[model samples]
Target: MQTAQRNSLKLLQWMMAASLALPLALFAFASAMSWISTSEAADQEIQRTLDVAHEHALKVFETIDRSLAEVTEVIRGMSDADIVAREKGLHARLRVVAEALPQVKSVWVFDANGRALVNSLVSPAPDVDFSDRDYFRIPAERDIGTYIGEVLTPRPPYLGARFFSVGRRRNNEDGSFGGVIQASVLPEYFENFYAKIGREPGSFLALIRTDGAVLAHFPVIDHAVRFEPSGPLGRQIVANPLAGARTLQSPADGIERRMRYQRLAEYPIYVSAGLETAAIRSRWVSTVAQHLIFGIPATALLFGLLALAYRRTQRLEEEASRRIEAEEALRHGQRLEALGQLTGGVAHDFNNLLTVIRASVDMLRRQDLPEPRRQRYIDAISNTVNRAAKLTNQLLAFARRQTLKPEVFDASQNVRTLSEMIATLIGSRIEIAAQVPDESCLVNADAGQFETAIINMAVNARDAMDGVGRLTITVRPVNDLPSATTGPPNPHGHVAVSVIDTGVGIPPELFGRIFEPFYTTKEVGHGTGLGLSQVFGFAKQSGGEVTVTSDVGKGTTFTLYLPRVVGEHSPQSLLAEDAPSVDRANASVLIVEDNAEVGKFAADTLTQLGCTCVLVENATHALEELAVDPSRFDLVFTDVVMPGMSGIELAEEIRRQGLDLPIVLASGYSQVLSQQGSGGFELLQKPYSAEQLARLLHKAARSRRLRRDQAPAG
Candidate 1:
């Protein structure tokens, strides 16, 4: 059983571990995947930002080219002479187009010699020398489609916001290089658009020319910080010119970032967007922390349950082991104790009986004994023998082996009759009261044992009251009484006879043991402790029960519940019997007993009562005498238990052979008689007087003759 329990606990512990472990394991895997996903997400975000910046740069360049084309159409087929000639009207047209664009600060028309013909801010065509500017110088050196100039704040006489210039080379009708069509682009316009993209902290965006000049930056730089052409990002850009991304340090802020760059389709311009590595890491950390917050406590709770179960299991095993040892020790002590008490109780009571018989016999040996004194001594021995017999019966009663002769009798009247004798038994100091119902409470039980039970209870009450308290005996019919053993209540009624006493009551703790034999609370000589046990056994054997209720300082009530038999009875009166007359004239007796002396004593005693006596040591010898003439002996008087073919068997054999002899079986206490029954024979209990033997023999013989005379002829 313990092993099964441990196995179950182990199974439960494993289940608990698995229940939490499975989810936490999945959560841990998910957290790792989420971290990787965050990193991938950071790279994707950077690429998308770069795309936005790339598109914005393309749109700015497209506007610049469009404005330059309109101006070129206005100057179609015209020289620097014609361009200066239409300069006023052209200046108004350039200013009208630049005013339409938020990003275009101004526009200039310069000839091949780098002399400005028309400009948007000063309409009369200011004499701005653009030959020194990169827009003009780069285009003059190499016939490029368009040249992107370095960012510059307009100096004196160049009125507008900070801007970079986009310039296109013009061709003559013969396809020779013409002057540059210059448009000033505002850097703040792209900066405002990048800021509007709403990147998180530590992120950066920029519009960069392939030549490593930053046109626009977000957050816009206060000081001019040029991009490194040979750094990590720059080297990557040089390796893969169109588009690339890498983890690199920012040249402006020196922060590590994942930076991506994309080149616009039609221009020598690249857009770069970078996200700080630390910010990406923070996102990954936040996801992992959430999983930990939920999983850690659940894991702890699983282990906590296992620890508690382990502690409880260990404690139970230790306690169970101790209990086993204690129970073994208790059982051993009880066996030895029970045997000793049984022997002591029988020996103690029998020794008193022996003392009486011994003393009386010793007195009978006196040579000068007077007749009256001899009779008294004889009576003492006789009474003591009866006492020894009664004590044996009391032992059997407690054991529930006593053969009972039951009759239906009124329980109320019985107790009332005993009420007078009870006063003499307990004493007059205690008040006696009897409460009996008008209807008789009849019960089929051994009258003698019932009376004995009542007397035992009254005696105990007297002792409890210390000889001076109220004693009440009540008898009434009851139905549906609850069983004493805690079984279902009896629907059939019972007669309840209660003996109540106003004395220091029984303590509740001692209620269970009060019915155990030789277990007494009285002083050593005052009780044999068989009284209540006799009550217990008698009630049980009679198909009834006994119960008790008590309060320590108030009183106690002992109730005996017997199955009530349906009957009406006239009130019974106690009667006394005179000395029985014995007539054993012309009687023939056959005695079968195992003991030689006891057989001889019976035969000799019957011989004095005028009976022919035959003695045998066992049933075999008695059968030998009966084989000669079965009818010669009037009665077969035998002991019930013997060595071989016991007296009951012998009597059975005689009846089988159709003998007319009557069988009279006797014993002080025979297992066969107590258990099987008295087998249709006159029973004379042993240690009997000659008069008892004589009376039984005459009765058996007379009964046989009467039966024979009553037989009809065939």
Candidate 2:
């Protein structure tokens, strides 16, 4: 009987649990249904809003198109004499037409030579030449029926506001092209009309050409007259030429929005309207919150009661399990965040570099450009390429993958050399105050990396100061150092190169994390978070360390401690030793590159540098050519990362064979070069300029000659 009573007690508990869970589940289902209904309604409302906006845009374009057509017809029927004479009747008709359409800014008729024959405004119009205008030139060249020109700032008699032109090609009685009848429409008209149509605060209305130029936009103050057709919006238009709706992230503001676009039937213009996702989500969230507010209290009450009853049964096990899980989750999240930041920064920087390169190349391809301007474009391309190479070098430094070509040089001299460049980079707002010791504090490290580190630190300091502050770069010898967050002291003594700035100082707690890759305190798009990481990597790789000292309101100092090298050589001597004069006459360069394009490029460049070139695909072929007659090649130019046999292996082979030839290994980023240490051979970083290649080749040839002369009498 006691056993039966215990079973009944367990059954009663189970029944109560079921009774509580059923209503809660049903309430959740009902809430989910309500949310779905609400979301659907919001989406429909957004569609309706877009439709209204599209219709309004279409009506505006139609009005402009009709007015232009009417003006074109009126001009075609009139004699050239009537237009040039500014006949009173013709002037009245033109004025009436311009007055009838609110969109029409002005109506003008031009003769075959592009002289302003007649205009709606100003009876005696100023002698303006319309011949140079794109609207006139395009129709005149293509002999098209109608053409729409890009937005342009209007001339006198009209306010200094932007307008787009709709022009029709006029013909003479003999069927020859007789200039164009151009009608201008004020962009403000469309902006004003769009403003009257209600929209959310962040919403935008835009009229864009099929080719991607922005004709007009609502909230005109924020709109750019020109937007790249290759941009996000342009790509979208190309994907769906007609009418469509899509969710896109705005490049302008980085906001995700649902955009509806329609291509106008009468004109080559398209209209787009966007509603921010945040606004839509807000409405949906409110609906969900309303249901949750009432249901949550009841649900919580029941769950709390059940939890209270069940707590003692599983508390210890649950607590221990949760603790382990939480720790693991935190670690995983941290790793993912770091990876994301690193990739994001790399992509952002490379994209910017590519944009500059692409734009410069495009400009260089223009045929009608003057010789001086053409040279300027070529120089711009070269400079941009160098900048890109530097960017990649910085990335390699941060990754600890770069092959450093360390040279013993004075830090003070390098700092002084870079002071002017630093001033320009940081802009006029920040004053650069460099204090270099009169005596050289020699250090063995890559001068380029050292300069890069200082520049990165200076830029960080500049940002911290909000672009306005005094920056002081000082180089002094440090005999003793206390080990702390900066790093351990070097037994060989160190040269302290410090970049000091009056900027917002870093917090103490973040000191340990600042050197970690992708760890930055800057806002997104403002920084890549790789600058400090590069500095840290560079300092550590150079047999030294980087340290920072800061005060909350005062300022901050970043010191790079490099092991001092006791040497008599000055910085200028080191530069002279590195770069030798090139006499490329009779020099034969054996180019070994696996990539066909790269091999061809190397051969062409060497030929241009006044060298006889022999191109080979790989190390085996290069060895064969050398074996045929080793003396035929004055220098062996090879890529480090190659298939079959690596450049380092080939260099080792050449040494093993006792070849008199000098080897120059080139690479953009090579693991082999980093691992094998360039085997004491001359290393050339890829994307090397013609001058750099020439100098390196010259140095290698000279080294070969010296080795030959040093050998015992043959």
Candidate 3:
């Protein structure tokens, strides 16, 4: 009996060991599979990126080829005498072509002896000779279809900038060379294009000749212009077929990279795009790290639970189980503490706003309150409500859920308008200066968000300087986007609104966390820490980015980059068209609202606006009211979010019924409105002021009248 009992105990121990080993083996298998999957996905993404780069390179070459074809045709039907007489017209045509193509810097025709003929830059041509220029000599000597020469800075009569020329030999109609029609492209143009398209920090793009001469290297290297095919990678590139991709280490930077090259069929050059191996590896590692972070903790917890179960059966490992539980409880406590801190900060801010509102209301309720004091109390309430609204807006911005009313406007003008208000807010202790350009710097974005971002930065700067500092707000154009690890790249020619301050700057260690929500270095009760985050969100939502540069002692500068708008109607002009000319008109309005109190408030506001209001609780009731008298109500104002049918749907239904009444959709925040839009109906954001409501009503009334007048006779 004793031997049997001992055997049973040994069997139980074996069972526990096997059970633990099973999960460990499964985890290892899962990790291996995950790594393989991640590696494959990374390679696929690299290939996709390379493919896109190849397409862009091809498109650029195709454009140049077409431009060359057109130029060749222009010079075909001209003789020496005609060339001189038609020089003006030829030069004008070349100038138009060059101006139309951003890549082409100058287009000109050179004689076989390299004497300047008709050039795009100058008329009554200069006595310049390019006889020694490679662009003229190469094609004149070689029997090649088109000759592309090494990049060089040309002498006077042409811009003294580095450019690579593409030349096609002109025939004498006897199969003999007459001259070379050449088009030169500035290397800077390629550099700008490459910079805009490059995805990684260390990535590069290059235009290289088949003979291994680098024509243009984006990020501009000194030795790249005359680079030789000496290194293993270079030799491989030269020996390899016209178009393909490969992985090799760069000799210039010693960085291993994945490169894609495409040879231009029309030209003698090839374009190559490369992404560093480190970038690809970093991306893969990040994905793996995320999986491990969650997986390791989860696996450990599972093992702990299994061990606890095994101990329960043995009834001797209670102390070990208790210790594991204690550790888990500690981790839980830490999470709760973090949650409490975030909620505490938000609750504290709202409480302060509420306290001001509560106190102002309590004072206003006094039976014998004096008129002057009452007005002061009313002002205080209004200020508090505005502050609360701002706080809510900030929260929404940080959450990336704020509904932005984006418009294209001159940012410089807006900054000038706000300069005075900013000065008043920051106080006389801080000197505010605005450096706005005379020319318009148009940007498409939410003007209000832009203003808020600038004000937030200014306020932060004031605190940093202890209220004595010089704040400079400058609006300028950005030729290239800032290099950022995250966020979308700004398009070429973006508008930058910078807020620079001469005050104590941010610390390097805190730079990475400054844009984090609820992450602030300020003293408690001083800030809610969502200012920079809101700016970040606004920039991203506007299809741009926000960047900051600072030193330990020197001042900080915050730049909000927004996509540049070429030409759009200014917001002021649009507002002027929409503005009410006179007092509110006496009209009938159909109000559809689910909330009882909100419906009553709308009715009262419309009554004050000299409008007869027909209040209904739902869309069914609204349709019923409309059925009673379709022509009675001049405008229909409905809540966008309702129980039975949405405001947008109701408007669609009314349109289907051929009703000419104007519809206005109101919403605090509605997904329907966000996705499908108001469908030609005017939108009024919740909590709109009386003046705003009056203007909207007047506009709606006018729209209804215009629609009725435009209808055909029955």
Q: Pick the candidate with the highest TM-score.
A: 1
Model 2 lDDT on a 0 to 1 scale: 0.77
lDDT of 3 by residue, 568-682 (tens): 5556422232555557678899999999888898888878878999999999999999888898888898998999799989998999999878888787663464345444456
Q: How many clashes in each structure?
A: 0, 0, 0
Model 2 lDDT at residue 384: 82
**What lDDT score belongs to each candidate, Candidate 1 first?**
0.80, 0.77, 0.76
Worst 10 residues of 1 by lDDT: 570-579
Can you list the residue pairs that collide in candidate 1? Answer: none
- Which of the numbered candidates is closest to the native, going by highest lDDT? 1
Model 2 Cα lDDT, one tens digit per residue, 1-714: 344444444554674576577766876787678667765665576667667867876776667667767766666666788776655666677788788888877777778878777777867667777788889888888676657788887766557567889788888878788778878888888778777764665566777778877787765664455546777666767788887777777655567877777887757777777667787777667777877787778777776676655454233444555676789999999999999998889898888878877887898889898899888878878878878878887887566677576677878988999999999999999989999889878887788889999999999999999999899999999886546634434555889989999998988998889888788888989998889987877776565778899997778999998878784654442223346557765578899999898889878877887778999999999999999999878899999988889988998899899987878888878566533445445677777777766776666567767777898995
Report each candidate's C-alpha RMSD, comma-separated, in the order given: 30.3, 33.5, 22.3
The residue-by-residue lDDT of candidate 1 on 1-714, one tens digit each, is 577557656776776677678877888789779978998998888888788778777887887788788888888899988877877888888899899988889888788889888888786766767688888888877787888888988867765578899888877899877778888888899999999884587678888888788888887776666778877767888899989888887676777887888888868888889888898889888888888897788778877777787668755765665677799999999999999899999998999899989999999999999999999999999889889878877886556556554456888889889999998999989999999998877876679989999999999999999999999999988884654353223345788999999999999899989999799999989999989987876676566778999999789999998877674542331111123566657778888888888888888888888888888888888878989987677788888888878777888888888887778777766567533445444556666676667666667667768877899978
Q: Which model, 1 or 3, shows the larger lDDT?
A: 1
